[model samples]
Target chain A: MAASMLKVAVGSRAYSSGIRDVLWKLGRLNHVAIAVPEMEKARSFYRDVLGAQVSEPVALAEHGVLTVFVELGNTKLELLEPLGPESPIRGFLQKHRDGGMHHICIEVDHLPDAIQQLRQRQIRTLSPEARIGAHGKPVIFLHPKDCGGVLVELEEA
Target chain B: MAASMLKVAVGSRAYSSGIRDVLWKLGRLNHVAIAVPEMEKARSFYRDVLGAQVSEPVALAEHGVLTVFVELGNTKLELLEPLGPESPIRGFLQKHRDGGMHHICIEVDHLPDAIQQLRQRQIRTLSPEARIGAHGKPVIFLHPKDCGGVLVELEEA
Candidate 1:
């Protein structure tokens, strides 16, 4: 894990980490999520037109989403559809009728530590606590306002 | 390659392969592009804050944007900042303010054939001809309306 600490380039005051908190490291991008108005159409487009291996739709009722995974060689594209009236995606779709890119999910080594460290750096999260994500892992969403207008989800690896 | 296919699950009528036109395939996702209002801050956030290996900013004068790459091991996140008033990113930033997810680039084995086939399927493109992308590859932007409100870029591999 010392290699993780060494990743902070030399002479960088941006981190201010004389403490060397190597407890967590951000990992590979898990998926780029797109909220689609039509789930089956999006699934067929990626699987058949794009010729990518796509997974069957999984309903994450707890997450208020129906997800279909489109497997790219390096990463994945998650197509999400609103499951219920109260789904967050429903509001997003109302604003963007044709649907649009929703958010991005990246893997993190430690969720709790990352959250604490991010908050210290003035990054606000959408929720007060971590919740189980679509992948059934501890996940928390950083506020898009804090993340340069992009909704970012950090999931435990 | 035939192996590029065989990924399509059975019972997909999307391709309409009565003529068996398998001339091109969509490959890996190239990158997810995000237009940021502030380049230096966005660069530092991904690098020092997220602890990712980030690339130096590259100015694309022809493209009218400055680009910084955040390498996520498996893929990349492209942070773009507008270079001039005429830049397309300028418009994006004006709308998003803090910055937002722009477009996703996907690789294709053959660009021309994919464009033609996509046109046949009623997929509208922003331009009739492919242009040189930031990576110096032939790329075309698919119309967002046709793609469920997602601006998709197809780059030739």
Candidate 2:
């Protein structure tokens, strides 16, 4: 939002060294997900302490998470807590006892096209097909190893 | 931006169980940072493959890291690479060979007031003082332990 306020740091626009990729355009970053082991403490920090608009905890049974949305004006932060024994983030919390920044979700105009193009580039996706995410949108996660070790979720927003 | 489109979501505003924290309001999220071990590959993945506008790497000797920015419409992702052997993120990269999510920066309207208030609440800051950050603004790093294991940078914007 304030990028224009800062001086131009030697042409910020990336000139792709390879063929211009125009398969599908990516939209804004939807949300940065944080796996919070201490969900109450995390929620209080963002809501009561930071004075941000925060949503109540919603149990996403299918996704195996109890999620809360913290609005940061421009975007949102999703605070996730393991809901069941087989919660996807359970292992992550076990490894990082205090919790941590999990996968980030970015919006895309055309999810199918984007997925196909990524696969063609040998970018491994966690799933072959997009699934309905907690936001009720078609979303697919990319393998962290293939994407430089950061889990990325592309949502059809 | 699309929060309204989602079902009411049980009235998404935090009512602050106690006194409202009006000391300082948090602005939009500034950037989400990722530490990159293989800088070239990480840059290409976001630029050539994701088709996102990324910035040229800028080395900040003081901060001990090389920074690249990926524009995500609403927000940005800062790609950080250790600048020297004693770089702050060096240990992080060593633990995570392929690199991983480093920190998330959030804009604060008033840095000093926010710092004072947080201190009173017993939330620890990595530094007692705010220093000029990569964006040339006063920023302070909050303790990850107190922040639910997320390294949060509060920048005065």
Candidate 3:
């Protein structure tokens, strides 16, 4: 019985250690934001067709855009459209030639600390300072050219 | 004084409602997985260069691939490489032309119920049945064609 117990203990230890290593590598997923020409049409596909729950639309006057949030399993899909001329979404649509993935936002525990770390490493940031996001959270954009063409957003949740 | 008091009460209500809406949109992020050609090269960029914490590589023999998890701010970046001849990542790499975003995984409260809901809606899934994922959690994959060319994974944690 003792020998059998020892064997079980060793097997369990091996499994747990492997899992721990994987967990160490994983962080949390932020929000996936998609740029669209029309917010209502995008919502129809994401909400009606895909069965994602829609949150009330928010209009950010300062940013010159309107956004609708779709609550997925455990993440939020943000659909953004330009409110008028000179909106960022308008520029994105013109550059990409179609509505697609715009950027990936990642939540950080500390906004200042994260920004400092990135700055120290000579990473280029799109915004010099954090700005108020759609949800009123402080957020900053990282230049895609520096991150292998992947636009990244660091947010304080 | 009575009129002023009434105005303050109404203002407070509006403020509270706005705050509630923002909090509701801030959901828990699960993980973002990226398809790469070589796991070692991905690790060098994400881990050594980006200073992201990493986990030991794990080989999923059945899936014909190896995966390494990298911890970012509040989310994990999963790097995948094809292992055997039957691996799907190889095809994904070829189609994409370079390592880019692969699939976004969202955590759900229930796996069976979500799968049933998707099935009833005539949505096609990669796997007919849910399988255990890296963390011993049930996970199912949704076909990209059904979701507008975006492959999604629903994980029960």
Candidate 4:
């Protein structure tokens, strides 16, 4: 594995050593997530109207949401419906009412390296550590505040 | 150069003939667009904080937005800032305050065929016709209402 040290300059100080982090290895975008008030409506729309194949809704109780995948040639569209009143998506749906685009997931070669690099640059990650995502892969979320109000998920490629 | 026919069944009608639409030719997602209130702040955040290579901001007068590309290994992050008070992004920024993800662009092999397919399915497209996009490629947008509240842009690959 090739590793490169990144010299990050913060304000007046130059924090240089031990930055033996791998170069940015985040890969292809896996999918774009959409928050919806109703999953079946969104699913039928894509399947019947858009002529796209959609997966059956799967409930990820741990994540507090029901998820469905709209299969595309290159990437997938994930529909998220809050499973409970306390689900995070419920808050988003309340604001949008009609629902709206949510977070995006990208594949990464090395999650640990990516997280370390982000932390070194003072970017706050949401989860304390990586967790299994709907795809059954290790994933981590970055705080939207740091990414211009865009929630980003990094998953193992 | 490859085409496949999709036999879609609508209410009381089975449209099977001339289904010679291109098989979901859209390739890997090219980028996800994020609307921001400030260009320089967002640019610096992705460049300095995220350790990503950011492009110089470019203004698209026709679109009424200034755009910047954050280059990643397999995809890109597009930052959009409204050019004037009348810009569409201005309204989004007003409502979101902190700005938010706007849309996602995907690459398609045959743009005309894709548009035709969408029309056959009765999905509303934004630009009555394909127009030049940020990448100077023929692109068109599908209405968010038709896409489960996600603004989807299809660009010629």
Best by lDDT: 2
- C-alpha local distance difference test of each model: 0.82, 0.85, 0.64, 0.76
Put down candidate 2 lDDT per residue, A22-123, tens digits, no spaces.
Answer: 668888999999999977888887876666767778899999999988888789999999998989999999999999999999999999999998898889
Candidate 4 residue A55 Cα shift, in angstroms, is: 2.9
Worst 10 residues of 1 chain B by lDDT: B11-20
Best by DockQ: 2
| Of 2 and 3, the candidate ranking higher by lDDT | 2
Error of 3 at A155 (Å): 2.2
Off by over 4 Å in 3: A1-30, A36-38, A41-53, A61-64, A72-75, A85-87, A90-100, A109-113, A127-130, B1-29, B44-52, B72-75, B95-98, B109-113, B127-138
Model 3 lDDT per residue over A1-157, tens place? 0111111122222211111112113234567887777676666555544444565567887988888776654556777788878788788778644466677777766777667766765677888899998768888898765554457787886
User: Model 1 over residues A58-109: C-alpha lDDT tens digits?
Assistant: 8888778998888777888899999987788999998888989999999999
The Cα RMSD across the true interface for model 1 is 6.4
Clashing pairs in 3: A25-B71, A27-B75, A27-B76, A28-B74, A28-B75
- Look at candidate 1 and tell me the lDDT of residue A9: 43
* The 10-residue segment with the lowest total lDDT in model 2 chain A: A1-10
Off by over 4 Å in 1: A1-20, B1-20
Q: Of models 1 and 4, which has the larger lDDT?
A: 1
Q: What residue runs in model 2 are displaced by over 4 Å at the alpha carbon? A: A1-21, B1-21
Which digits, one per residue and each the tens of the lDDT, describe model 4 over residues B1-157? Answer: 1224455443333332122334555566778899998898887776555556567678999889998877665677789999976787888888777778998887878888888877876678997999999888999999887777788888999
Write candidate 4's Cα lDDT for A1-157 as tens digits.
Answer: 2323455543333332222344656577788899988887887666554556566678999899998776665677789999976787888888788778889888878888888878876778998999999978999999888877889889999
